[model samples]
Target chain A: MVNVAGPADKIEPSFLEVSTNKYKGILSWLLTVDHKRIGILYLFSMMTFFSVAVVFGFLIRLELIAPGRTIMGPQMYNQLFTLHGIIMIFLFIIPGLPAVFGNFFLPIMIGAKDVIFPRINLFSWYLFITGGLIAVISTMLPGGSADTGWTFYVPYSVRTTTNVIPALAAAFILGFSSILTGLNFVTTVHRMRAPGMTWFKMPLFVWGLYATAWVQILATPIIGITLALVIVERFLGVGIFDPALGGDPVLYQHLFWIYSHPAVYIMIIPAMGIVSEIIPVFARRTIFGYRFIAFSSLAIALFGSLVWAHHMFTAGMSDTAQFVFSFLTYAVSIPSAIKIFNWVSTMYKGSIQLDPPFLYVLSFIFQFSIGGFTGLMLGALSVNIHLQDTSFVVAHFHYVMFGGTGFGIFAAMHYWFPKMFGRMYNKKVATWAWAITTIGYNALYFPMFIMGYLGMPRRYYDYLPEFQPYHVASTIGSWILILGLIIMFTNLIVGMRRGKKAPANPWGGATLEWTTQSPPILENFHTIPTIEKGPYDYSQFEIPAAKEAQ
Target chain B: MFRSASNFSDNVDAVFLYIAGLSLIVLIGITVTMVYFVIRYSRKRNPVPKNIEGNLTLEILWTAIPFLLFMSMFYFGWVGYKDMRAIPADAIDIRVTARMWQWSFEYPNGVKTDTLYVPVSKAVKVDLKSMDVSHAFYVPAFRIKKDVYANKNNNLWFRSDKVGRYDIACAEYCGLNHSKMYSAVQVMEQKDFDAWFAEVSKKAGVQPTLVLQLKK
Candidate 1:
């Protein structure tokens, strides 16, 4: 074990000595145990995977523009959509905000030197990369990538000629990485809180992460087993889900949704946490109902686990079972609505700042509400019978995932970019990106709801000519969305070098993460900060002398 | 491109309209409140806003109201799902097998066809299974979709309340020809369905005859 340095050890040797040169520092960044360094590592890796997956999404949309295989053949189209689902869900969305930003900020937010297990934090990033590599390499294999979709439902998973096993194995491995990260975060939050930092005193972002960690720890193992069973069925001819062997395929749906239903919460809770942070900061007041909002996260997590079977209503479950699941699904929406109302109430008559982060947060409020409402419709067994596996289901999820978690990520990126890189992005460009993305996202997904209601099914490589208009509209919107994303990322990356240097607390927020210097030192905090009040109390700080100097 | 069909289609459409209306009302209410509050209480207008921490009464009201709204929706959904699930006793039975790139339907009279044929107004119960991958049997006109799995059987029944042609497509992604895997549903009058069945059976006679002889 490495020796633990004392606080008095001011000249402690660096973990990896780097030349003062920039490129060498970049190399050191690739292999480091420092939590801050590892967080940036996850950020870049997830962004790369996200970019590739977005390109895949574009290809799928382009193919559907005129209905009958416009851009690619049926087989290629199948691969493209499947790849997009697997990459986006597993590599990007699942770990997108939590693993990257959470790892970077969680310790700092809670006033800790580092995560409770720094080595494990670093290892999670490597495991994520390795899993991503396995998935990427499967695409290059002989028959091309697995086309069983991300769900990899059995029988087809066992029988497909594509490399289904490797891709699923990659997913299973990634699930472990997620579980470990969850376990680490849970322990860090529980055991490593600074002196006098009570659970209630911890920032809402911490509360959000805390709830998500519970979900990760409890729910990921189920998917791990479910994916493992698929692999076993594929390779060993285990008839667990193969009808020829007298196994029940419905069991696979049960097992898969058991984990996946909560996985949706895993994606959104941290985002809610991000919103909680931003809402109060911009409103310049204490959050309206801190306890209710914090508890709502926990409530969503607990209730989210029970609603998985709603996904199985049309898969031939008994009517009684369907009714039960349908009710539970609707019940879960209550907590989500609570969080939304709480956000709006938090901003009620409060001093509101319309910065880039707040803009995206407000966008999330509107878009996620639409998504949640549509979700309630799907939860109704009657409506689901008409809408399941249709473009409506597609629209509902994109609204939640993209509009909810995706916007949350973008907002957090803008909110934290200053702290992470010590630079400011061009506000004008950032605003343009947000506007284009919001409009383009709606344009792409809104028509899906209409087409779904109009009876257009999803996952088809070809469709009747009558459905062409909606597909064309969606495709055009996708192009615009891509353009917005390109501008957003380009501006951020370029701004790293050219933008003005940021102060320690540019937003004047009370979270302990803002206590450190921008682009924090390896130890993070020079002196560990102790929490005194709730995270949203901006009135506590003295007016900056720098403003007078300016 | 759209045409009025029968009572069943009308019922389905009514359900859609009801849901769409409810969703729109909620959307409008939320949007109006959100926009009004933002503009009326802007920081420029009132820089030092109220610092209200928590309101128990408002929280309870929000929670209770949504629960009530959701219950109403659930009640309608329950009735609709019950209607969707209750198949008639005299319904025709058909076996449906979904593979990677094709759908095959087998009728009770021992006739197998690539496309589905059924009598209009007679409920058809499809016992679906998959040969290789999981595929969803989706008939948008019937407003029904069910996942067909390799080792498991899932059955869904629907009556085509009209005599017309409808498109059948796989709703789940399997592989390669997933998009190309299409079929047609020919809903005909009872007499017409029998005639078509007889004609197909006549063409399939010799093999049946040979099997019977071999058994004898």
Candidate 2:
């Protein structure tokens, strides 16, 4: 059996210091097996890919500011949006929270030295970068990038003569990386918890990662094999998804969404876990319904997989298939609603701190509600007929994926910044950035709902004159959102470089990570802690002094 | 106050309003409660919190209430869908063929036109087909859309109560000019539609086939 904790050494270097000193220069990072270091590596790569995809999205929005082409032509516009979807969905959000925060915090939260397989953890990061590089490099190769949107609906995908093969190959490799990461996480959680920790005693975040790992393991291969089949059809002219041969195009849709829909849950469930973790800490109270929240994570994973056919409602399927999918879609919304109600109730009658992290959580709740409600509207068979393939679908997803998970990511950055770096970000500036980002985000996505209802389609390079105003407003909103992001990132950078030292328990968090040193030691805990209470037990501690000042 | 023209639009819009209204209430209820909780229970106001861990009654209420609410939404949606799927026996059948960047409608009398024409308040069943890749025959005013797959057979039916030109679009992304795949549904009075149908039949007979021109 492996040791739950290392030797009791009160004075030791942090993981950063030890890893850096143990090896010289870049080799220290490149060859390190520490989970925290791997997490940082994922953060840099994900952010870089995120920034590139954001520019692609910005240009797409800019080109839509007018009725006719404002910047790029039709072909270029198609390619940009396709690349945006490929990069953002594959390279960024799918692996985002789990790769970055989960890697860094999961083992630490569970009081383990590192992940069960630290070397595999490092190998996963390498696969991520290799896959990401191939995806980006394909953009410069002949035939440019794929223009089939990210769905790569067959017939069109097989028929289109772009550099789709490379993009598909990149996604296949990335799926392998994701599968390895998920397997590692599931094993680490199973075998690496501290002595006293039990199934019910685990933090909600760990449960979230556990559920997401199962999804990553189960659902990712469907997309990987499906994408590989498409590549095969493209090269060898097999009849898997080609209409010219004896294949069905709708079969490709069913297979694609089978994985992609659950992939959305994979993206958001961890974010929900982040919300569950942050709320009780900032609220200074025990979680209202811990078991409900934990079980709901599992419920979401199971139910999320069944609702994949909802994406195929407009794909010429039978009414029976449509009804079944629509009903299952509504069924999946209950767990999410249960989570939302529990989160709001947790804040009730507690000593709440209106901190930046909590503020992001608040925004997450508000935005996720809108996303959820709109999702219901889309799920409604009649409403879906009107809104399918329109800008409404586009807006609904951004609200959920970007507004919900993206905000969850920001909250984690703020909530755990001090714990990770031992430095405090400027709280006032973070607050301002949060405010601006919320305003800009709503401004950017809200009008798409209206125009989409008024009959504007999504993925259009040049729209009718009536849609010009909404597009113009959305374009301006993109500019504002980017401005806010710039300020937020810059503030984080400056704080990391020069800021006051953070306390070990800055926000008075009650998790095991809070019990450890800020920027935790080489082997997280000197002596393994025996958990006697749940993760949110606050009776033994008091709220720390306001750590607002830099 | 409404821009709807087809029979399905009212059903679609009513469901939208039903869900949207309830969602607004839930959204407002949650947001107000959240903001109020923040203000009413701040550390300054409530320094020490009472550790009320779990309430089975409240958890059950929330879970059961949303489940019930979602089922009602599902019922309304299903009712609207049943109406859409139940095609009338007297409905006129028209063949709709979608290509790379165009829509063509074939009348029962063998009259083919680039734009769709129909009599007001009369049900028209569209037999949707695609020549190459998949496209969707979408008309927002009618609140109807169905995918036009090449090797698949699909159909959509709608009856417009008002006589006006509504935009028809390909909702599914086809190649280079998917946005350019825009046509119009000209809903006319019965006599005018009959006359227009006769004129188009004569012209269609004179010309070979306009659809073949755009065919790849």
Candidate 3:
């Protein structure tokens, strides 16, 4: 076994230490099977797409600042929003936490050396990048890119003059990448846990990934097949969803959402896992209702699959069908509510640390509640009949996806930055970033609800004069949100160069990752840790005096 | 807020308020509890955390209470919707066909118009159909929306209580000119609607451009 008790500077070459590796230069990372390197690859690539898509998102807000074209024409506006949706939903958010943090930490948290299939893990990354590159190239194709929005609703998708086939092809390729990642994660979790790490004793993050992995495997294939069918319809001239071709368009929505709705859980569950991972460590207490939180993840995965029809409420369905889906939607809300309750109680009467990560968690609780509660209004059929296609729906989704899942990624980033990089960011600036983003996030989306309630449709290239005010406020919020993003990324980037070196277990976390060196050595541990305590049993946690001195 | 223009608008509003109010209460409660706990149990204040695993009773109570609350919401929502989906036998019928960027309303009396003309204080059922892609007929004042799908005869109805023009937006995203798909519902006096219809039929062979500006 590698030495574990070495001095700070004497620690062995970490997975990040490529200068001393025999592979040398670019080959080191590009050809590496190290899980940490793969995780870093996913992290860097995801951030790039996230940065590009957020700019596209800002352009959408800018165009909506006033009626009539602000910068570009309606055609460009349609394409921008469509690209933003595709890149953000598929390339960035859905695979976000599970792919990035889960790749890096899942094995470490469960006290394993690497994923069960390291080469396949690397292959998944290549496929992910290949899918991304194809999307990038699709825009440069013969007739420009797909402008059917991200949903790629048929007839429009089939008949659109723009180049939709490549975007569809890109999505088809990406689904394989998603499925393989899920397969790898499931096998790793199933087979690679340390001998003493019982299923119940694993970190909540691991449980979250486990549940999400099932969704990625089970639900992703449906979308893969559906996208493939759309491709076949396009090139082969076999009609599946186009009405004129003797196919039904509504059937396409059913197939898309069957996977896409459960895909929502794929995006958010791991975020919940991130919140679960952070709340206890920062609160300095055992996570409340560990079993409940773990089971709720599975419950969300289960109920999440059945409620896909909620999205089809106004998409022409029978009342009985609507009633069934609506009730199931309400049913899914229970598990989400239980998890929220557990998170709040986990902070109750505990030694709460007001770190940037915990601050983000507090905002997560507030913002995600707004997202979830609005989901209830949308779930109620009568209300959804009015709100389904309005800005209210847009606001609700952003509050959940961007506010909940996006902020969860930020929280996980800040919480684990030290451990991941072996360096620390400026806490004061990080705190400022969190506060500004929270305020800016609420300001950005809260007005959409008002406009939506008063009847403003989403995806409008030019809106009426009455909506100008809400649009103005939303545009201003986007500016503030971008400012926060700039500051946050800059601080983290700069800190990586000049920041203080981090110690193992910087947050006094009780997981096996905390037992290893910061930025962790290749093979992860000196020896596979035999766990005697659960990940969040913080009574066993002891903070280093240096952490208090900070 | 804009004026309510339909018979069941207030019913939908009441349900919205009930759910929105409860949501506000729970949202505030969640925030307050979270903030209070964080401050009350700050590391400086309580250096040693209470290593409490959990309380089962509290968990069960919250779970059950929220479940009941949502059930009540579901009931109220269904009640509000019953009036919307039930079309009266004596209701006036109009076929609404939406294309890429416009809505056309066709009357049973063989008159068709780009703008909807319905008599106030009478139940009007709209048989929604799409010529091409999917589009939702959304009139916020009346709180009515139903998807108009190609080759589908989905329908929705409303009874106007106010004689005024109301905005109708194609809520679903159709192609290029989706935003310009703005139409208005002209809820007129019964006599006014009859006069308009009669004039349209009388001038059926004449230049129709001037008559389109009747509301211009």
Candidate 4:
């Protein structure tokens, strides 16, 4: 075991160097119950899948660079996009922040040594990897990858000759992983907080995790049922979702969206929590409207569930159903607005540091705003009719999912890299990467809004020559985006191998995780400490004499 | 280069402009505030940070204002939608059937065509159904779309003031040749449309084989 001095006991090694299990080297990692190790394992797996999916996404964009048949045919293009969505959604973003950062920091943030059910947490990882492998394997199997898109809209899904069953099984298994992780986080938060750490006293990141856990547990089962029904219908010729068998396709839409819609929130909420956590630390101020930011997470979860029908606006639902969902979709926007306002206001009159993490947080705000506004347009009944299945929907979600949560994931990686790996990355490279990424991201997605408004439908293998210019620009933007990713990830990897040792607390301010050692000890703390003040209280760091001298 | 030929396009475009205008203002306001805060209160310029715990007034104001603003957005959207839903009494009913890779528009006089033919300045209500999977009838110029599902009837109504051709696309993803599912709405003069309908009706009786051509 590689030994390094921990914060309290100089002899104690960090969690990375030691394992609870009696094993050496790789086995120690493969079979350990340590939450931090599990988090690292998740990171490795997620990045591998993310890289693969990124190539698929890049290829998809490349194929769309011209009007007709740039590289691949329609069937291959369809399959690539489907695999990209399945891998990105099920394997990457859905379990992303919660699995990596949440698993690593949630217990420590709450002053607990480990999650309430550590083995189940590890089991969830196994399920996640297994599901991910099945999804990838389906792409290579006989009938080729599923081409019904990630939503697997019925009738089409039922009619296609693809190997959709394996993909469905992958999603179903991944749902179990998601549900179990949520169950663990919910229970851990409820029962494992340090003494005197009440509900409001917990960090906003914890609150974000708590809120997301409830969504995962409650909403994921519906998708499981929906996917299972599709598989059953495929095998038994059952009249569940297939219209030829007297079943309602719209009913399947309802059931599928019921879970999938909240699944978006599942992707974003933890990222929001990350935004909440990083803003105050870099700003060197108490977060503005802490209670509102905390409460909005719950509000998003509750109201986000009710607005699934908004996706079905053009799918032959009643007008009453239409307007009701339209209104609720608008209502959901309020909580997200509250969050953005609160994040921005946190910067006011505060000593701000333009750190790499903070830079990402700023981009998240900027891109998420575009996402939120376009989402507002889509939520409106009149505009949705025009923009529903167009490239506008494509651009809008990328702004939110990729721009918001994807950037959030990057921010967390930058913010916590030092703490996670006990090494600091090159700040100059990270900043340059961020700048390029922001420019590339906007260039890639912004044109879609205009083209979609001008009648460009999504999932078209070939488009009319009119839309070719926008597609070419977007494909070029993807190249720039990929270049930025390469630089950012390479800098991080190089820094990890050979860089300055990180301090226990690199960014100043308050949080329970920051109080521990870099890479933290086997049990996050030498002794479990009791909480006394709020998570963002910077008053302790400010001595009156020091302040007066300054 | 965008088309605004239908009655509903104006309503939809107005909503789009209203939301886009407000969103731009709000976005600018936010980005400006954030950048200003970062520059004005940089750690070098203002080392001692002020720890102001949230203002109750500001919180309530942001929440209440967005609530009102969103409610107004909902109102405008609902109004336009109501207009679209409230079909006129004298609307022409046409049957639209979508299959794997094609669309067929059957006129009221039993004249079926791959391209949708409707007279100008008329409220044409198209009843949509899917012969195979789900497909959506999307006319970008008209700013109207409705998913045509198998075994279910969904209808969309639009009135075009312009006498021109507008592109019709299958908005939903339906299997292999989905991108090739392109049709057009030929908005003709009322007299020209009547004459064309009469001529096609006579030929349609002898050519029942035309129906089989449209099916696959």
Candidate 5:
């Protein structure tokens, strides 16, 4: 019903110069309903939040560099650490790839001009920015930002005179934004793919986003309700979670993890999609087990939701409940492991090119493997009882969230840099940056595992003398990691402003996105394309006519 | 190597080693295979790629093997965990209450102490309670930790095998001074524990109803 392919003026230069809009300056960007423009706006907002969260993280590390207070008191330290988690998890990582890259590329990859609901798309971005601003304003309030640590566990959250509700409210509002984005994506995928493109022919990345969107829609409401309950308990004296008013606190943990655990899959599935996209492009081979890989994404999403209670192993539930959750946790790992096996196999006996993106993928596989296997360790009931709330758990989280998702982000940025903007970055510098960050990231997190096994707990402002050495090593690693990030991002900014032009299909990618110009025209395709093969069918690409790409 | 100082420690460690050791093997194997494949199939070396769709046999083999492997791991973990969770009939009872930044331990004789004192070679069940926010009672040497919940009956049991002082910590993130919420568990011989228990009984107050119900 929608005329997505646009008018016959196919000679339009780019989306940036949509002469029909005619409203020249900042108004065009602010009021634009274009999906590409909306995606760029999301990128800018995430960059700001991510930069602040990184600084907050670095400062937390600096404080923990010694046995006692290094720079600030415990009150200030608690606020800084809590802010970092709140901003990083809520403001940055959770909404990251799905909002920015997914919005930008999903329509283009599926031969759609725009998402089904463009106004809602822009509204979600506004919601995200508003939620982020509330968090910043809460920090400047009378008592300071939330010191209840992002979980905002009961009693402390109720008793702490700090700005708890505003921060909790911020997370609540952000959930609305995520849910809307998921709705837009699911509808667009269902209604907007080109005529000849069947569901199986869609790129693996779209499948990844599809699975993630369902999670966002399904899992986000529980957290919203949970946050609302917390506020109710704090102000109106309704003790749903606070034990002070004859309430059950463990129930709060159950409800919180039910959403938060699946929220982790929402953070991860898109990253896995990015990995799938990168491996096939660099390997120059049709993906092995395409159906299996696609279904596994769905499997990860489904199984991921069921394993939330594994986190509550130490919470003293019945033996039957613990056993069932632990068993389900083991089952969940199967789909994730299947993905890893298929990724490695995709590389076997194929033409491999070690570009910056591929290099990041290599390290992603290495580091994410550690993250996955250690996750199994945490899932084991006996082992988890010992490791819960320890630095080992902290290390495992970083290995997955930071190591897996963070590296997946880097890989996607490099892999799609030429397509998003119309330029190529300095390859040599990019490679160097990857090596440094990979080394620094591992160095920063790996030591925490050993220290945790040695009985060092997480979320401590200060620790005993025995932990000083590991903390010192971790702080030094943070410096290297930050340095690498700076160089990588600076190279990208310089490239976007002034660099060599990028070709349409730089990596010989077989996706529909590579068929269009870099920084695609306003109405994506010159004409709607009819799909005839799977997204990764490299055999069709071997023809000489296809070799003459721009 | 971890100090196997509690009866459950060795069992927990065995499960940990079985999984961790197995993980080391699998991780290294996957990494090595991946690196090998990358180098062996570089564009310069293999200009043309084989259009091999895939082998169904190989996919089935890998999936089935991993499925069976984890089931074994689940069994190993569950068996080790079952014993620690079930408190023996003669297990000694200690009531532990956790607040924002401190720990309190109450013995059967209505004896209160900052440090947890128990007889070695005896199963001790700790009845956990939180006076404020959620906290976790953790003893790494024993490889045993359980959350202390408010308005809930949560408990964990362990038998100390070594006669020495070990650490007790609040593993959950409770507010400021959480790191300072540290105490020691003195695992003493039977004679030493009996002597201290007799002395504490002489100077003790009335026993709480919770401990009295446990005695019944």
Candidate 6:
């Protein structure tokens, strides 16, 4: 047996033990079942994945700098874009917010020591890593990675020489991981709330996660089945979607969109939750129409599922299907509109603090509105006929994904930086990063809208001479956008080592997370605290001068 | 314009216009209300606005109104879909096969080509298939798109109003040259279509032009 020394007999090491909890050492972190430690592990892993995917994005932008292929050939370009999409959506955006920040804060917000299923929570992270590794391995295969886009529709996926099976299998595995995390959160929220923390009294972030979790649990299974069918058709010659085999390819689209349309909500709702938390704190007021905002999250989730068929409008769907989908698509916009209304109303007449997080929240509103409106335009059957598969669709999703969800991630990172690292990031660097990103984002996406209006289609490796200028402008703006991201990450990483120690309540928010020390201990709470008041109770904070002085 | 293409296009256009108009109205109304509220309740303008919790009536009204609006939209959408589903009896059948970087169109006369050809002002059905990978056949002018899947056949149809050349492209990403996989649609008058078919048949060494004999 290996010799182990007692605590008192141990020689004096350079570092202090930093003792307090039952867990300690590197192995404690690597083998940790603690939700908070697992969350931190997820956070770091996602950041690394995000950085890798960003490189792919920049490479894509680089290739599109001119009308024709530049650094890479057409085939390589296809692989790059497909891998970029897969990595960004599956590896980053889908799991990025929920798995990292959600796991860390959800339990603490609900006044629980841990999530309802802590072991499953850790298992989800490992599953995520396993899925990510499979995707990475596909890239190393003999024929190279999957050239099929993230959707991986059948027939072509059946025939493609590339490693479609491994790539698709990766997505399928990731979907399972996503479903488990969603189930975990839903159960935790339902069964783990502290005393007096009723539904209405709980924080809005929890509500947002609650809605998102429902979508994850209900919709992800369909995609799982859909992808599995595609893989089976590829290997077994089953011909479920093969036309020559008398199968219906349109049916594949129907099933794929059925899940994908709601998956967009899975991407956005948690970010909305992040925004909800940041907004009330900065505004220093109760959220306007709290019930409306909370219910709207549910409304968006439910309606979001119904609108998936809208993606199939141009896919030779029955006119009746197109009309119904178009109509339902437009209807879904109402709840999203309600959400925007409530966010703006929450800011009305409030003492607003224009911090980095608040700035991102403000930008999210403007960009998300534009994104939502454009989605309405696409939902209209007539406009969709004109804009389908065009640069307009590209611009619209970027506004929602990059502008909406991406900005929300930035806001969350800024807001939670102190809590995660126990150090404050440089505000000056953050402001500059925000300014550059805002300007760069618009410059990159806005021109695509113009090009799309001029009738330039999307996914083109080469374009007509007329569309060249817009392509040039978009490419240049992407570089600027990449620069902003670089600056932001650099600032945060450097600050972790050299930045000043942050106070517990750096933003003066009344949330339970704010009440704890910066980077709380392993158990999260020193003692489980009970909630007796609503989340936005500023009135309780007002004390007499004599009491305030103490 | 309503009769030029298929009835499906007209219905699609109608639903689009209605939704666009409604969305515009909602946008303008929301913006106006927000601006009005901000200026009216500005901190400088009003030292202390009422700390009202919520208006139950307003909440009920907004919720009920959107519900009604959604129901109406859904009704029209369902009706429009019914109209689109009934394929015309006289629809001309064409076979489409999509590959990684190419699209092949096969006509009833056993004529195969990379580009699609159709008579103007006629309902044409395309039975789409894929040789490898999934690809979406999107014709913006026709307002139709369908996925061409490997081993599976999906069909879509449309009628062209104008006799001209239009671009046909693969909407979904397939392989490295997905962007390069593009074809063209040549819409011609019936007489011109017959003559072109006859000439192509003669070139292929067929004794009688299948298309011309069928017309006769």
Q: What is the Cα-based lDDT of residue A420 in candidate 1?
A: 87
Weakest 10 consecutive residues of candidate 5 chain B by summed lDDT: B207-216
- Each model's lDDT: 0.82, 0.89, 0.87, 0.91, 0.86, 0.76
Better of 5 and 6 by lDDT: 5
Model 6 misplacement above 4 A: A1-25, A233-247, A318-320, A453-455, A542-550, B1-52, B60-100, B104-114, B117-134, B149-163, B187-198, B201-216
Docking class of 1: medium
lDDT of 6 by residue, A1-550 (tens): 0011123222222111232235678766666777777777888888887888888878877888787758888767777778888888888888878888889889878777789998898888889999999999999999899876677765566677899999988989999999999999999999999776889988888998899999999999998998998888888888688666777767887888888889899889888888888876765667777788788889889999998887766566666577667777867777777777777776666655567787888778778877887786676555566567789888999899878998988999989887777778888788899888888888889899777755577767777667778888998898888889988989999878888766656776777777666666566665677787777765544321111111
Between prediction 2 and prediction 6, the one with superior DockQ is 2
Q: Tens digit of lDDT per residue, candidate 4, span A416-492?
A: 99889988888889999999999988989999999999999999998999998999899999999999999999999
- DockQ, model 1, C-alpha based: 0.59
> Which CAPRI category fits model 3?
medium
Q: Estimate the TM-score of every prediction.
A: 0.93, 0.97, 0.97, 0.97, 0.96, 0.86
Q: List the residue pairs that clash in candidate 2.
A: none
Expressed as tens digits, the lDDT of each residue in A1-550 for candidate 5 is 1222334323347776662256877778777788888888888899889999999999999999898889999999899989999998988888888998999999998989899999999899989999999999999999999998888888778888999999999999999999999999999999999977788998888999999999999999999999999998887888688887887777888888989999889888899899989888788887888888889999999999999888889888889999999999999899888889889999988888888999998988888889988998888888888888999988998898989888988898898888888688888889999999998898899989988987898898888788778988998999999999999999999988886777766788888888777768987886787777788878755522212322
TM-score of 6: 0.86
Ranking by lDDT: 4, 2, 3, 5, 1, 6
For every model shown, the clashing-pair count is 3, 0, 0, 0, 0, 20
Better of 1 and 2 by DockQ: 2
Local accuracy of candidate 6 as per-residue lDDT tens digits, B4-63: 243455666676567656766876766666555545654456534334445677666676
Off by over 4 Å in 2: A1-11, A20-22, A545-550, B205-216
Candidate 1 ranges beyond 4 A from true positions: A1-24, A541-550, B1-8, B194-216
Q: State the DockQ, from 0 to 1, for candidate 2.
A: 0.70
Model 5, B16-89: lDDT tens per residue?
Answer: 88889989999999999999999999878987887655678878887899889888888888887898777898
DockQ of each: 0.59, 0.70, 0.68, 0.81, 0.70, 0.30
Evaluated at residue B9, the lDDT of candidate 4 is 90
TM-score of chain A of each: 0.95, 0.97, 0.97, 0.97, 0.96, 0.94
Q: Between prediction 1 and prediction 3, which has the larger lDDT? A: 3
